[model samples]
Target chain A: MNVTEQRLPIIELGSLDELWFQVAGTRCNLTCSHCFISCSPHNDSFGFLSFAEVERRLLEAVEWGVKEFYFTGGEPFLNPELVAILERTLDFGPATVLTNGTVLKPEWLDRLRAAEQGSLYSLEFRVSIDGPTPELNDPIRGPRTFERALHGVELLVQFGFLPIITMARVWDESQDAEILGRFRAVLHLHGYDRPRLKVLPRLLLGAEAKRTCGYSASDRVTAEMLVGYDTTQLVCQHSRVITDRGIAVCPILIDSPDAILGHTLHDATRGFAVTHGACATCYQYGAICTNPSSRSPDAHVRTIDRT
Target chain B: MRLAFFGGIYNNHLALATAIADARSRGVDAMWCLGDLGAFGPHPDRTCELIRENNISVVQGNYDHSIGHGLNDCHCGYTDPRDNHFAQLSYDYTLAHTSDDHRAWMRSLPAQQRLEINGLRLLLCHGSPRRTNEFLWESTTNTQFLARLCDDFECDVILGTHTGLHWTRSSDTGSGVFFRPPSPIHQVKLNDGGLKKTPDPFAFINVGVLGRPENDGTTNVWYTLLRTGNDVRGGRSPLPWEVEFVPLAYDHEQLAREMQDERLPDEFIETILTGWWTTCLEVLPSKERTRGRW
Candidate 1:
């Protein structure tokens, strides 16, 4: 490690609270302009995780006391075993699947709905849509992709699944209220009245670096920046991503060579150096990758006088 | 030994009064409250008055901590904008209505309380034993994690109430299809609907809340009653402590009418009347949220 890298803050894995699987790997059907992984139809640098591989990780996660499981990919539905994978996951605990929402089918939804009902856990779907209108969303995502994703949302709602509509903030931060207002109105028009929305900060990596500007040298998370700060806000403190290559530090940094920590969950318990520019974004927006239900309460730690 | 545990009063004086009487009628030897005495209900002082008058032991909840120290938010751990908006309204109202003496008393309350009943060590807290505001939702929290909490805290039973839901997970019951053994190799045990035997069984119980309906479409609220028999064949009691979730019905309509009079948000009133949560929907895990009418 270099001098600056040596001085970076090392965050230990507090517990294996969340276990994520890169089910589809870096191969998405839609080439979104701001995809941090630069995933595309032809971008097959990584490979899909087979059903057996996912099951192995699930069993391993139980050993670690994993609280929840998440499935993501270029699109998780692109894999034929996606349905079975989620069906098996509910038997373990609550499962969430992150998808582009364009490739979902009725047959898959039917089985997932039944599985969720049978299990004691919940099955959540997070559908990615950039903005409220087609004009705003289509540019970042591909053309006509807005309407197709919206249909997917309607289908999920029809199957009694309330999908959390996740959006990457492409507009100015001040426009969040107005954009969310319009997004809620639009979702209400479609069947999702009580829409759950999550706004993600832009991760300046991969395709996003080429589309906009990459993080400058000053954007790194320094060791001084973490003093007295709740490091639990950082996803690396309590989570790990399982890819076909190995167990990565987190989902956002899977593309980085240094991100892959080990071949097994037990091997990946070592502390990680928060040196990447994306780590700065994660620091600013605490627990950005986790479901709202799973987010830690450490950010609100206030010193109260008991005397 | 018979003990009654109340969770999250939320300034609902009517429910608190009803619950206290119900427990008394059931011949409870001791009464304990899991804090959150103020929020989303009218007459914050009334709830405090009832607790003090009845001499109930209380552990500080996030809302109680915030109100005691005059913090900005309830620290309920809501991330959604809409949830925060409603939470702010409830906190402001509770802070303004709570008396200074009650706030001082709340400030003196402990974060967690430990006691031994019938040879069972019980740890009572507003949320998890580690954090005052941590949410231990049923669908998201796994058995091994619960076991770890019990082991770390050095308790056989961990009773918490923060997610406003009532549920229980026993170490021996095996929550998922797979049974987690001490060793990783023997993890996969297809749940045959029979409880697995464990040498040391721990239990984590979210003892429901008296603050509001559990988003289960019922106006009636819930509390927990833990009872242990006197028969002791071995070193421990012959039978384990039995947990019963007692649903108590109060005059919810009167509470709703009072809230409307105090100008509390209509959304808060809707939950009290309809028994379905109209706000704070974001913090719920999918399993809990799916069971509710938003």
Candidate 2:
């Protein structure tokens, strides 16, 4: 294997638990107000990872015992080689692609189904819908983005993909039950067999830094906290995510310079300080980086990394 | 009935003997066996064989059950698909690498053990009586706790050995729903002498598994010192027993490999490694049981 200079940043990365790829880098059709990376139609700070690059990492990860893969970006659906990447990753293990429901074409879904033909490990799609109603979602994700995303989700079901809808815990604790209830009911109308849901604690960074409040002085993860804490639950302990620029500590901190891991996974395996304000969230919530209940996944939707 | 209280005796026979000695020191009259008597270190068969030779009451847990049932899975209910893959592999490796006799012995054990202690009918289950495979930690629901208390075991007392928490709780108000001290869960009821005020309830105490890590991240195993303190109203408070874990070295890598092979879910493997998810599990202090604790 003739290797050249790597594209991944020198992350001093945490653990490389899974092999990851991004078809479309910082580019996204919808400019979600709360996007951690502030992805938008024009944001190209990161480029798409090539299929060849992803395949190379997949083979490399296998040697090191990495057995899972995830694909994400502004919207993974925006990538032209999205289906090809899924086709390749599933031969060895399961692959999950996170997407905003907008811009998903029915034909693309049919192609995805065709590629997933006899594979034992299924392809998972997670659709990010911020609110149960367009009123709640449109405010953050832009006008009518919620409806388009929901429409995209329906197409996925018609094509045999069970899309998991991810949400931020926007409603208060009192309205949580009702919020989730309305959310699930809407998903049911869309023909999803089991509507999976995820509620993320607000990461006051990136575009979200402006949506409400960014990290305050109190949000930082102090050194004293890690002394006796079981930091094992933090995703950075055992996993590093790969993006077009380089391997980063996790999908959440993709934009942070500190998260920019080395070009190669071998160089990425180093200690990281849970320094960022978001690290506090991970520390408080524990296991904030990995999926919540991806095992025995709901046959359609897959949710991970809930602290 | 002979219930042996064992704390951490992996492969080191010396530690095993020490646990036995500790149990005897407390004047305990029976033998008890917590699961994972094997896996994670060096010897799988020896650990199982030693427990068998001692004639300790063994209840096959998720690990023990997996190895015995020839399940290529650890079945710990882990959430990560990849980690689940790892656990399944560990399960397979344990099944293929371990001796056939060991596998059969692991399978032969039951979830619940029956015993008769001083005119008291008893049910001795490995983890919890309801699901032999479920790990009842501090985060375990009262419904789960109460259900395990009154479930199918028609015994007067329910003795479990999984979660290493050692507190004897009795239903003080309703039936028998006792809450112990600080499982890091808020709203825990005060552990006052409140059982006599209850309806009809027995006892649910984690005798503490004789093997594996304790709550403080230390390797010590835990057991209870039941003083049989007959309250003025007529009840017994299970006392805490101090017994050091005799660390045994078993094929942990092999067990991990087996879990990986069986593709047991990752959340469960992690739970087995680290006791229970403190976040998902809540502790709402002792409440009056809605049913009988028998």
Candidate 3:
């Protein structure tokens, strides 16, 4: 085959360790400028998954020995059936939900807290907030989202939930210490004294691509990159995303048409070619979507260069 | 066959001594130490001396690999800056104190061990079979993922320890609930090619470490004993086998004092004195973190 026909680096599914559900689909209450999928209140390209659909996938996941389950979308809370879905998922194993932390209700949190307490697994909430304050966060995430998300975080803490506050890196890398210090202080003031925080590398896709120049043509994972790399560091090696249409390779690639590999989890277990610009980001920051408990890929750790 | 497994000794020579004595007193047929022979404790040479003297079969942990090859860091893979700072302090201390001969021995250790005991293939690893430094916490790891490990590694039992917790999950395919949706939500049950029955059962055991207290507000650390063999009747035992987590108390005060004498971080001594982890808290899952005082 010629260079055009040659395959990109193909990463085989190490194991169906993480099973993700795009529960709310491509819709969000606050449309962040850096939204990888450009999810918004009106983006209906994809749709919410019903409780029955989620339940069915949960059953399928059990046989595959999936280690954990995750819920994502425009905002998982926007789906009316989300609370029920999470309640059901806790029964199977650990569950995690990625949200903008703007559309939560106390009653739902109460019921979910009870469900999590009753189960033998953990239910993790990852709330996305771009920056420490509105000044830095508002421009990326829409106006007024900072306070609303903070309120949502406060609600989570009230119900005995230690939600992990996730921030997309938007400023110079040198400013991380100051930004994180400010975030911790603010969170402490809001009653979250010991806040768990995660700073994620920005993915240059969707709205982000348009907002800040898209990826260069050379920003693609090449076959040579796999020579000594531990492929397991890449999410595509150990995770698959469930969408309304079908199962996709990973949460980061759902918007790519070729990402939908098959209708079932088993069929989707085939290798995925790292052919897109987002693949480079995934390579740079490994297993970016997995819960802290699941252990982030070692590729992200920057230590003294031993070799 | 009766066996004892130790996880992440972490240079706690005193604890390692006591646990070995206790296991030997209990009539264990064999003993194994699951790597991580150094770190977070004073006198790294002492633990190395004891393990070598006792003939403990070992697996190479991330720390062991790093120290053995003179790597810069312990490679515990902490993402938090504070956690990494403390980890580097411990790693540098350990590397500075460990003897060259011991590091060479660690370099010669295998990454994994496969043994057949009582007709069961038991695979011993410092972490998960696939990765040496992987953290397999009890609350976060599930049954199917373990079953897949068994299938891939082709073992009846896979034993690993790195998360500083001890737990066991039996993938006995015969257990009717092996692949069933958990009881609370079983409305949509489906048998998607459930586990097939085999002659023997499968299991995964995290033989808890002897390095430090499990952050359970107790000064006692744990080791695991696997009891497998025929019963008094000379036929196969009715329960097939048993997994027992043996917690042993040691003179942690002495260890803490020794650490202080060596000018080790107060944080390390605090964990010994209080039985609560002060450093390396970043890698802990929520369940484990919540259980700790710090």
Error of 3 at A125 (Å): 0.8
DockQ of 2: 0.03
Worst 10 residues of 1 chain B by lDDT: B184-193
Could you report the Cα RMSD, in angstroms, for every candidate shown? 5.1, 22.6, 4.4
DockQ of each: 0.48, 0.03, 0.37
lDDT of 2 by residue, A1-307 (tens): 2232232212233324455565688899988888878999999988888888888877656434343577888888677787787887766555678888788887777877876554534466777888789999998889988888888888887876666677876667567667877888988887764565656667778998987878766665555445555445566765777887888877788888978768887667776766677876666656543344322222112122334
TM-scores of chain A, one for each prediction: 0.95, 0.87, 0.95
Q: Which ten residues in a row have the lowest lDDT in candidate 3 chain B?
A: B181-190
lDDT tens digits by residue: candidate 1, B117-154: 77889999988987788888888887777765765577
Please list the residue runs of candidate 1 whose C-alpha ends up more than 4 Å from where it truly belongs after superposition.
A1-6, A296-307, B176-199, B229-239
Worst 10 residues of 1 chain A by lDDT: A298-307
Query: Each candidate's lDDT (Cα)?
Result: 0.87, 0.58, 0.84
lDDT of 3 by residue, A16-134 (tens): 78899999999898889999899999999889999999999988887677888989998999999999999988777888899999989999999998987877677888999988899
Write candidate 3's Cα lDDT for B1-294 as tens digits.
788999999899999999999999988888999889989998999999999899989989999999999998988877788888888998999999999999999999999999987777889998899888888887677666676677667787888988888988775422222453222121124243343544236788999999999888888999999887652223333446778899989999999999999999998888888888888876676666777876
Q: Tell me the lDDT of candidate 3.
A: 0.84
**What TM-score fits each model?**
0.93, 0.52, 0.93
Q: Model 3: what TM-score?
A: 0.93
